[model samples]
Target: MEAHHSEIRILKEIAELLNEGTEINGLLSEVLAKLLHVTGLSSGWIFLVEPDGKHMLAAKENLPHALAYNDCEPMCTGDCWCLDRYNNGRLQKATNIIECKRIESALAMKREDTNGLTHHATIPLRAGNEKFGILNVGAPNKTHFEPEELALLESIAFQIGTALKRIKLIEVEQETALTAERNRLARDLHDSVSQLLFSLRLTARGGAEMTADKETKETFTYIQDLAQEALSEMRALIWQLRPRGLENGITSALLDYGQMLGLKVEPEVSGVISLPGKVEEALWRIGQEALANCKKHSGQEKVLLRLSMEAHQVEMLISDCGNGFYYDDKQGEIPTLGLQSMKKRAEHLKGQFKLKSSPDKGTTIQIIIPV
Candidate 1:
């Protein structure tokens, strides 16, 4: 009865994790971590085929509290035995670590190549016809993984691996769609606004001799300057329209957005919280909105943008020296589209976002989210 109850409880927890709005890594980490608790293993992890197919991404277990993916680095293609099996399409296990000689040998090569990994069991992880990566179990004790334990780990890996593959495919589709939209926007800018700017410049230069009165000449010059300023803004927009590829992970996106977001207020930027591009894009959008508000309504000369990883979540804070306002005071009162968009974005991520400001004080926004 006791054993049966434990199994039931474990399944419930697994189900809950699956239902949560966690990314692939988080879900897998939970599955593996629970299995480790039940089987009494020291450590476990999930791995995935690096998107480029050149190496493997050492994924984390979906535990309640654990290491961030950025804190964990992946092994190279030729270095991981797990990747070799995943690439070669095979699931391997070694009972007593010694009995699994062939796999252990391959793993040892990987270990030497990686400098070393703690003792572990390498199981090929997959979904349908595709191989994701591998599930590995590690313990300080040499004889920690028995045949039964290995079987359980492999079973867990099977289910988790399949789910991971599905999630990753969805992510790819999203990224592709985003890239297409960005490119389409870029084309529109280049064809329409860019062409218009060129024409305006030419027209201004050609008509320079049309007016000889000093005031008339000054008016024409002012119009030309306005056109030039409009052109500059359009050029910046065009740069953003060029979609960054999948290779630009969360850290890269954060860095890129930091520069752009800080341009107006010249905020002090620090620490980078890196995740996938999707997460980064969301963060960047929120940052963009915050900076826009600061410039438009906050009446502040400078703002601060900070990004960092704390516990299992990513944190971003944007504060400016301006009259502070209550977050809910104008909840249904003011109809600012930019602030609405930022709040909506935070809600979408299952995160928390807040804005505190006053009429004569300053504004501070803090956004906390899980990656």
Candidate 2:
């Protein structure tokens, strides 16, 4: 009766956490530890399956040091047996996985960090047919789970699955709204601002050609040039707001953008350029900002963009042979020319970003994101 009451309390606390809008990561960490404690389980971990279905991102893990501290289980890894089974559609319910292969492998290799974890259980975290990932719990002394314990574990897994499904649905709705807004903005820019700019440029040019006085004509010509520049900038903005060529790929879209800006940007590519839609969108925005910065500050028309895709990562480099900032430049301190935005985009993708600048030297921005 006491154990049952403790389990009920744990479930109530977890439900509160979920209802209170705790982020998935924090919720998982807190709930896993609480569940392990309430159920008297040794340890536990959770995995979140990526949208691609090919990768399972390690969400949270709390375990004894022998299994946790080793290279075999360093928080997260792609080479997980449970994840492989989940991906292959073999695991669809709370099932008993006799032993952790990683521990066995480590023991076989005589690794010092090997644990005496001989058995564990895996519960498929799911809401109806929509599967999220797996909830795994270690057994106390490698003991078997009683029928009641298994039922309780399944109940907790169901709670986790429902929470994850709610979060996933919210994310989907948010993305849908965002995409709709982007389309509307793009349409507005194209139909309104872009047209006005084009009309202004044409009027300015016509006035410049008809004016009899040389001074008046020169002023009109200057206005015409300014209008032309504004029109170009507007087009670039519209392109970014609604990318059409991106349907082909990011490289093609970027090349098209460079052409629109009247600048020759040659992007050297290695390996296949394929990425998740969100990731591609981020890169596009970052690339647009980088190019805009170069045009507004670098005073150079031509630049080099390099994109390299590797086994587990993608790298991007934008370099320009133009006037760069000095060593003691205040620009870096001030986050000038959308550099902060670029950095944020990279960070959002869990990537590394760097910018190099020096007086009389070229500027280069490098970004690396793991796939």
Candidate 3:
């Protein structure tokens, strides 16, 4: 069985890649490419479950049309019939989707690009009771999968599922370690540095008030002011490290942060501020990032923040009336790293994120996440 030998080789390659800590996207792409090559399939794709559990994210796809068209990804924009069924809990194993509704429907509309694609098979990537996502492989005008081929595909899917689980575990471990380190640093700063700074400020103030000589009094006054500023900065740093009152809610914590930053943050609320812990945490981090960006680049201290909660969703908007960048510029023309990071944070929560900006107009950042 040359085919069996090839399958084993592919699995080994994937295992080696995992050991090297290859990113999930790259790992999926390589695995899909290898599987398509070995099985002589027309195309393949991988869909991973997002954090929200309500949406399936199209992680990687290698298709003939996409490759021919410079990797155009329509799959990322719309959901296909196969995915619809999968989301509805119909997909449980390696199963053939006869006359894939997506491809067939496209063919019916005389879309020439979908030619020869009649069906595909979906294999659920799962680890026992935990299901992660799906691995899909399609053939040209093929409506069924052979038993042996299906078995090999299932085996590959299982391997992928185990790898995904391992990656998830690694991420959780890293995040836990990071949080613990932050707490330790926060405690040290608050108990040692902050207290010392407070004492120094008080002593400097007393010395300045009691001094008789003009020059000596001025020197003590300067020291008192410097120590006071240092204490304030230290408290701000500690707040960031371990966000005090975050457990109570984000509203109060954000207001306090704005006060620390010497910014007039106008808040507008529409509904209940209650939210899940993860949702609150994401919002807190996003708020911090947005405020930091404003302080660094906005050229204005006042900012407007709005939080709205509807029956099924939560929305946040942070706007600043300051110098804005050109949003209509072509690729590589605009600074996008921060914007991309904020968008990623929202997407990680299965939310919609947008930034609006113009040369003279101000910038507005908005995120709407379904609860």
Candidate 4:
């Protein structure tokens, strides 16, 4: 009866932590630390796995020196029995893993800093049919876990998994709300500021053409030029807020955008244009930045855009034939805000971004994103 009360206390504490509405990573770390303290475990870690089978080490606490070596590189990468079983649908509940492959590898490497740790308990974090990832807890010199201990871990895992689902749903709703707000703003700008600028340009042009005095005409012409520039900038801002032709596809939208900037976009597309919504959005934004850069700096009116899709990944290459500035790859420098934005968009989706350029050789940007 006393042990059962202790288990209930642990569950209540963990449930409170999960309900604290903290960010996922921080919350997981805190909960892991709390679980270890209350259960007298020495170490723990949490993995957040995506639908694509890629996993991230979301949290860890009290790792031994062997696994903690090199910033916990051992835990950060490669596969192990728990993850394999989780992916293969074999890890449905809390169970004792025969051994931790990562620690085993570290032992074989003769680092000899495991702190007497050999095995761990792996609990699958799941809310019904939805599987989030795995929770691993271990202690120094502990090779197995009791049934009641596993049961308690399983209950904690359930709370964590439900919290993850709730957080993800909230994020999706927030993203949807943001996109709607952006579209509304884009429409308002198009109907108000954009139209006002267009009218201003026309009025300035008429004033210039009707004036007889050279000074007055010159003043009017300057006003007209300023208005025209402002109108162009407003249009670019509107496009950025809510891309106009994105419904058709990224390629079509980019081609239209390039033409708007007075550049000829030569596009080569392989495979169908079907892609996940987020992936397509990222690619479109990156393409917009690349094309805008080409128009602003490349000194050429023509740019090359290539898109290829494979079974597991999508690649985009943007290049120009104009005068490219000197880019030193050794310095790992991103020269412009546009390039940085493109790189960030790619990386946010676990993609790769590459750029190449040299004086008089033009610039090339390549992006590869897994599907």
Q: What TM-score, computed on C-alpha atoms, does each candidate reach?
A: 0.49, 0.70, 0.77, 0.96
The residue-by-residue lDDT of candidate 3 on 293-318, one tens digit each, is 88878888899999999967899999
Give each prediction's root-mean-square deviation over alpha carbons: 14.3, 5.6, 4.5, 1.5
Off by over 4 Å in 2: 1-22, 29-144, 213-219, 326-337
Per-residue accuracy of model 4 over 1-371 as CA lDDT, tens digit each: 99989989999999998898648899899999999999999999999988778899999998999988788899888999999988988889999755899999998998788888899999999998999999999988898888888889999999999998888788778888988999999999999999999999999999999989999999999999999999999999889889988999889999999999999999999988788888998999999899998988999998999999987789999999889989887889899888999999999899999999998999999999988
Clashing pairs in 4: none
Cα lDDT, model 1, residue 282: 76
Model 3: ten consecutive residues of lowest lDDT: 64-73
Q: What would the TM-score be for candidate 4 when compared with the true structure?
A: 0.96
Error of 1 at 270 (Å): 6.0
CA error at residue 113 for candidate 4, angstroms? 1.4
Top lDDT model: 4
Q: Which stretch of 10 consecutive residues in model 4 shows the poorest summed lDDT? A: 15-24
Q: Native-vs-model 1 lDDT?
A: 0.61
lDDT of 1 at 186: 88
Give the candidate order by descending TM-score: 4, 3, 2, 1
Indicate which candidate wins on TM-score: 4
